[model samples]
Target: MAIDERSVHGGAALVLRLLVCVVAARAVSAVADGPLLNGNFEDPPNQSQMSGSVVTGEHAVSYWKTSGHIEFICSGQKQGDMVLTVPDGSHALRLGSGASIQQQISLTKGLYYSLTFSASRTCSQNEMLNVTAAPVSGSPAQTGELPTQTVYTSSGWDSYSWAFRAEAGLMSITVTHNCGEEEDPACGPIVDAFAIKTLSQPEASQNNMLRNGDFEEGPYIPPDSQWGVLVPPVDEDDVSPLPGWNIMAYKKSVKYIDSAHFAVPRGARAVELVSGVETALLQEVYTTVEGSWYRLEFSAGDADGCASSYDDGSSSGMKVKAYAGTAETTVDVDFRDAGGSKRGKIEFRATASPTRVVFVSLGYHTKSDNSGTLCGPVVDDVSLVPIPQPYARRLLL
Candidate 1:
């Protein structure tokens, strides 16, 4: 059969058009999955939109809507005797009492997203930030409060993270200052950076029963941050910022440290129980076989970032207590040790379908430089594997 020249040329043109459409779709998806617009608050407002440092217009800040009293702060601006700090960029936003800033974000429905932002207390010791995510399609909102009373880093700034599941294609994120009526109207937290990351739900394999055991999959950490992100305690595991793990302590949080700032025994990240027994990390593995023998292996060590000496000379060591179902063990780490970390193991029998694993610090520790910053043992490289009955009998014999 003879092919017509016009038909052949037309077919080739159609194929080229299809490829262009596919490429365009991928580009749009990439932008949607990336960072938020003007998240670092580096985009300044015009002179008409500002009255001094306070924002006078509602939509003054680019890509955001403001309500009530909102101030645009510079990096080294002084407020009374204290100097304001903006670590993420040259500018930040200060939400006064009853003030809030919100932006509409594009997201994939039903997927979990972790929001990381750099915040610090600027005024009162009880300053707190209330963050909320509400769907545009009339779905329920997810809200959480971040307390900035405790300064984890010497820089007077710390990164905080929270997670929420998207319920619609478009969601609105709002950050408000939670202060009482009698307090000063200028008292609030300074917010410098905002970042969002989609979390991939991890699954267990034969080698490791716990998902995200290595602490590799979690919230986003700023590139310039030396102090680790703080994962606040959540009532439910489904909304946990740290994937597959729940902070089980009331009004406490675990410091998610990175290898760039602290010594990690394994992987690029780990968790530090900074609040002694007040902070607990808990995870439930659903793959556990009932009444089966299993071995729990983990690494517990000091980050070696603490102070060299305390007034009582008793804060030179760290200890972590681990619990697997009903069986438990304690691992002690001396700060003078060379590696700054050590490996530990525990063997236990599964009591139920979902086995509970928990880690908590036994004592309080502070930095050696007299900063009085809270520091504790680092937990990493956790794994749980089933042990054969025959092998268990031989070991016991």
Candidate 2:
């Protein structure tokens, strides 16, 4: 061996130089990854569903995770956007088993951007890799570009992220992965983590916790409405019809295995407003406020979108519970429309009694999912106010 000219310069100076190089490299790497937002994952309120909001049943997912484990794939997606390339490639999450693909974060307003992930067509047909995104509010999303294209080794956690315009109310976000048509098996096309993030919450909203595992935080349908606080959804077998007395509207979220959630009087056709459609509770109410003009409002999003989409999605008469101590129960409607403003609504009336009612619930007309699955509306702002009574003779032909 020969003596090297680039030898240790009195040890200390050499160490200092090496440290400087390491620090520089780290700084550059950090800048390359861009800035990150500090935050915590949460759930919704008042019977709001959480079954599929986050996952980790397998493939390293989130199991009711708050921090550490990211909000990988919200909206009932288990395998998440992180999929196996086929011939055997996977990831490990600190919380769950499968890999995690975090939601596309929205830091500032009006900053458009793109996202990307990694995977290899290294193996054969058994593996498949694809990319997709959730349109923030559970709707159809647009397409963009990817950063580094190919993947076969542990290139570390490097994803493509840029600024974007949060045209939407900035209420929600989503994440999709590279896993589409299974071309073959050996193509071994799959990925573990599509994305990851660190989110930060505002100062005041902390008290307004959205997902404290209780479904209470909300910009809810009835923003001013409060839960029974004393009365909640009775057990599946608990035949507790929402207390009719001292009540205006009682909408509750029913949690079950999937959107196949239904109630007693099956085949009776429940109508309007249902969340976690894959499996949600049945909202049953007593109404018939005609003359006493009553407007029943119901809005549900991402409830039952999978196998159910309303093409001409219209809200019609509701199947309601008729009151007991009332006369001439069939409340008539002079005019009807779901406000045509919000994502959902409906109106009912009772030209006579003040307390008389008609029962109302959700029913599906077209179950073919003309609308996007998971595109259910969140019900809110249900109200009742007396509208001007029209002349009875003018109502009919």
Candidate 3:
């Protein structure tokens, strides 16, 4: 029984090679957790890579690729008489007319991801940013044009969220300034605090027939931001920034607020209908039995201290109208109420298979402080449950 040394050596080498292959494969498939790299734009570019504030090279900004007229802006940097405002950090990137910046990210295919970023208009009133996520396979990209004309915060900076389903394992997220040539090449939007969050698919449970009823699962909000994230209007529910809900109205957006910034009714997050009737938050709950009676419960209130005055010296108060299929009800919460929020309910018979539930603000409101900031009723803790046939019949009788 002679043991061949060559055979033993060959086997040992094969095992070592297999181990190395496994380790390399794991490294290639591993995706980074948390936000994207250098998301805040705090990492400065080299002096050689920058001509004053304008980035000259393609990869001038750390962890990002730049093209055309891109500028690295600093907090308090003055452009003429106006000083720049950096919401997330001391530094941000500005995409001039036709300029763009992008970064390649590793993502899990088939998973839905929400990209949250802060942007502010620098010059033109109708400035727009084109955000896109392109896969490496050359498939159709997911793109959205977000308008910066409507500023939500007094700081002139508003955090926005957009969601898309990943088509491949590797994709590039790009933000491009859509404006044409202007008198000032530097006139554009300042973008900062880019973050990404993988959203969990919401489902109906026994406790709550609606998905994400508490509004706890949604886009990523910067911890230091005083203003909540704005969930931009989207026609489809699958691509909505807010999971399980869609912004059904055009030229309208709903504020996805956090308890840290505003008082939430029941959970850490809630939806504020800031644009009155223009803003509509809708969700289609499935598994609803037709002709079955269901009770919809929710909390409506004023985001305390959000606006200087809730009343405009008129009888029109802050109110929210909830619509369940064909039935609807309005809930009014006084601005002077001690409690920040009040619970409201609406009972209706399901008219469709997947009944549509919508919440809309009743009247247009602006802050009494003369800031002209939009304000409306805050909605939270939404729940829908089917009532027993006997109980429903008794109530009807």
Candidate 4:
């Protein structure tokens, strides 16, 4: 209700108001809670092991099993006495070449769950890790691929997570080190902060088509801002605050604007593709019904605290495109008039298993302040829902 009435006029205004109503009525299931035992590796109850110790089944952390060889790393220990900061806990897990750790959890068939953890390189070189989730109960077993990640932080750590649906009653999660082929085969990946939690059942239109669309999960928020612009290393295609969302900023600044400073139309955060002539944010959404019509609804406007605040005279705009292979929908927006926010939409039929959604800044506006920051389009509250009975619009009325 706290919208800028003047943002859109006449037919456009009416259409947006209806779209917002539809968005609010979408219903989604609730996620169950509780930490998967020793999720933070802060277990063993008051005991911290020194470096260079191997732990396996029965001797490893409670409810965890190991294969090949796994190392026990206590909190405050450096990575092999090197400069790299270790895990933030009383204990963590280390894997060498061919080493792996796994845990099994009881789950309901057809339920969705998310796995999150922290990983860091144990040496000066980069490292890669492979993670998997599969069912053990059903005959023939149902195994699914979870997201695998690489660690290259010279002196820090990074967190990664992914969501998966359970096809059987028991799910086994395994994390393996894939960096043993380097010069020092002993150097591998250090892991900590493990967690497994049930996610709400996904509902299209009622459910969010895009994962982490609100920019809520990602790197820590900086001291002064509500959000942070994620920039990738040179040659890397995607660097984003939210998982599954790729940010394409060729060195230009991007804004992870937060509600702490500006008016967020939906959640606590929004993203602004600032700086470059054409920076983009993109993601692929699964759970689509092939050949079914769907509606994509979202809000777009100018972000605050930048050179081109909404009230400022600078121009801000972007082009939003959604496609499943050949079928696509595109829309353009000019945020100069969007005060609180403006709602926009695109309708299309799914042609593939996953749909690609992209937002790219159309132009580069000059900096409004001393800082050389250009104001760009702000986007948030993106969602996709199936259009019920698209073919049966009217019964001979």
**C-alpha displacement of 244 in model 3, angstroms?**
0.7
- Identify the superior model by TM-score, candidate 2 or candidate 4: 4
lDDT tens digits by residue: candidate 4, 1-397: 7876676567697898899876433211112443456665666522342234666343346666677667777666665456444445566777887678777777788866656566666553545566666775554342322222322122346554545567776777778876635676556777877655565532334576667766665433333322333333112232232555665544333555567766667777787655444466767777777777777777776565333335654444455444433555555655444445677776666778777777766565433443443455677887766677734243213
Flag regions of model 3 displaced more than 4 Å.
1-33, 306-316, 337-339, 368-372
336-366, model 1: which lDDT tens digit per residue?
6343777888898788878899999988877
Residue ranges of candidate 2 with Cα displaced over 4 Å? 1-196, 201-275, 279-374, 379-397
Superposed by TM-score, candidate 2 places the C-alpha of residue 127 at a distance from the truth, in angstroms, of: 9.7
Q: List the residue pairs that clash in candidate 1.
A: 306-368, 307-367, 307-368
TM-score of 4: 0.53
1-397: candidate 3 lDDT, tens digit per residue = 9999999999999999999887544323233434567888888989999899999998767668889899899999998999998987699999898889988788999999899999998888767888999895678699987877888767788889999898988888889998855678777999999888888888889988998999999998888877788898886634877888988766668888889877788879998888878778999988899989999999999884433342454434678899999989989877652339888888988878889999998887665556666667899999999898889998677
Residue range with the least summed lDDT across 10 consecutive positions in model 2: 220-229
lDDT tens readout by residue for model 2, 1-397: 8865557455768789899887544322121122212111222211222233333232222221122222232222234355322111222222222222343344343323222222333233322222333334654443322222222123222222211233442312333223233343112223322222222221212221111111222110111111111112233332121211111223232211111332211121122232222223222223334355443332222223223323474444322122322422222211122211122333344544334322322342222323321112222222333344563333332
Per-candidate alpha-carbon RMSD to the true structure: 8.0, 18.5, 6.3, 19.6
TM per candidate: 0.88, 0.23, 0.88, 0.53
Q: What number of backbone clashes does candidate 3 have, counting pairs of residues 3 or more apart or in separate chains?
A: 0
What's each prediction's clash count?
3, 93, 0, 3
Stretch of 10 with least lDDT, candidate 3 = 24-33
